[model samples]
Target: MSVMIILIIVSLFVASGFLVAFIWAVKSGQFDDASTPSYRMLWDDATTQKKINKQSSNHKQKSNGN
Candidate 1:
């Protein structure tokens, strides 16, 4: 039927759009840091908090100086 043909055409277009997006993602280094994300959760939260506090204190000092 004509409706089936139209459905097939629309499906092909949708599939191609997805394929193009996937290809673009691969070329754009989106997957380059695959390992980092998986290991990031294992980092110590205390260390991160300390670093953030230090940076904020530095910023505050600079603002107070100006």
Candidate 2:
């Protein structure tokens, strides 16, 4: 059908747009630190963990008062 032809053209345009955006991101160093993010989660500093625990406990106490 004629509609199928138009749909295929539109889909191709959309796919090409995504490809261009991905290429731009690569050139812009958006993915340069690829491995650091994966390792970041494993390096949990103790001070930040203590602060998070303190905040959560405070939040729980405040919520319980309601």
Predictions in order: lDDT = 0.92, 0.93
Give candidate 2's TM-score. 0.65
lDDT of 1 by residue, 1-66 (tens): 999999999999999999999999999989888888767776767679989999999999999999
Best by lDDT: 2
Determine the backbone clash count of candidate 2.
Answer: 0
What tens digits encode model 2's per-residue C-alpha lDDT throughout 1-66?
999999999999999999999999999999999899887776666667988999999999999999
Task: Give the CA lDDT, 0 to 100, for residue 38 in model 1.
Answer: 67
Itemize residue pairs with steric clashes in candidate 2: none
Could you estimate the TM-score for every candidate?
0.64, 0.65
* Alpha carbon lDDT at 26, candidate 2: 97
